[model samples]
Target: MDLERPVQIVWQGPFTLAAAIASSTAPSKGVYQIYGQHIVFGPNSLLYVGMTDGQTFGARLAQHRDRWLVHEDDVTIRLGVVADLDSSARLADIEALTIWWHSPPYNSKNIWTYGGGPLRIQNLGARGRLHPEYSSHWKPARTPPDGEHP
Candidate 1:
């Protein structure tokens, strides 16, 4: 991945699984965001950020629907299709950066440590609650002073 160029993600939809499956433009591999009610963030809050490698967006979202449908909140999904990516690593980098930046309630990993180097992501179209751009870089761990115990 080129650190200089921002990865462009073309976002579409706050759709249900059935709707996404029916859509002609949805991609098979990309990052997705799940939105619904949250105890704290309330209605239409971003609940999770996830990526699909080999599976279609419909299939990936079906899995989430199985898990989330039991709850009372209505689940909606938004797909982020990368407009310029060289490899799957770029896809994972996008997912990691999005999760790290957004800190969605259901996403537990990649909030602290991510494998990729510095990356900048540009979200285009229907971003919803996500930032328009994200620049991800490593942050040094804080160390306590000589007499202090953490």
Candidate 2:
């Protein structure tokens, strides 16, 4: 059986509090990722993956403007629209799969249970972090020159 892959990032960029609030393209319903160059999870950077159904991306992103930023000046947002996952259940599945694959610092790595049972597991690491369709377009995180701190 073939395993699913990581969600694709359709759009991504560094944003400030004011920029995030003003961006109109982020007002869609989908999954989002927040990456920070801080020590939230550990020394190897941090990525926070989340999803939104009823709430628009713009609104949800705006909410994070307050406390989500571990590094005020070093934060980037990656937005991925799960076209296949038009339902809430599918959205949650994608979110869970992403968390499992990347094991981002901000996400829980514990066994996820639901409806009095364990959540179904799948192999999502086959295609790397971003979904296969968008994986080719994936750009490694920008790093400092050499001696410069990230």
Candidate 3:
């Protein structure tokens, strides 16, 4: 099954949304390296470094969000494809090095998403990932509780 669920990156005019999805498909299973970071746009305009392969790359970004819904929040999870061995000293390196590189943009936070660390769903309805904890803490004032509104 394809692990990297395709997503669109809504950027400036130079980069069209269609272009991002065409390239963001998940890599094969053998093993891929990456640097992923979470971004929440609200006039702040910042970015993070992230990576993934046939595993968590696609959905994890969606995990680090709020409104549990993709179309609702400003945070967009993105993973930077990092090629080369010695990328990480160990498996833990995945989270360590990547988050380290994008620490400032990540607000000095550590990324919990890693090679099948958790939250792996092999089916559609992927948007169910929209859980309160997965959402960004900084959201609209009266968005209503999880089930109450959405």
- Count clashing pairs, candidate 3: 15
Candidate 3, 53: how far from true, in Å? 5.7
TM-score of 3: 0.32
TM-score of every model versus the real structure: 0.84, 0.59, 0.32
Each model's Cα RMSD: 4.3, 10.1, 14.8
Tens digit of per-residue lDDT, candidate 3, span 55-86: 54444444433323234323333323323223
**Residue pairs in steric clash, candidate 2?**
none
Global Cα lDDT for candidate 2 = 0.53
RMSD of 2: 10.1
The candidate that wins on TM-score is 1
Clashes of 1: 0
Per-residue lDDT tens digits for candidate 2, residues 1-150, read: 113443333445445546655767664567677766555553324467787778777788778776656344466666666544445776676665555445566665411322211222322222224434322122234443566442
Model 1 superposed RMSD (Cα):
4.3
Candidate 2 matches the true fold with a TM-score of: 0.59
- Which structure is stronger by lDDT: 2 or 3? 2
Itemize residue pairs with steric clashes in candidate 1: none
Tens-digit per-residue lDDT, 26-129, candidate 1: 57778988888899999999989999888888777777767764573777878888986678887888898888777787887876656777798889999989
| Top lDDT model | 1
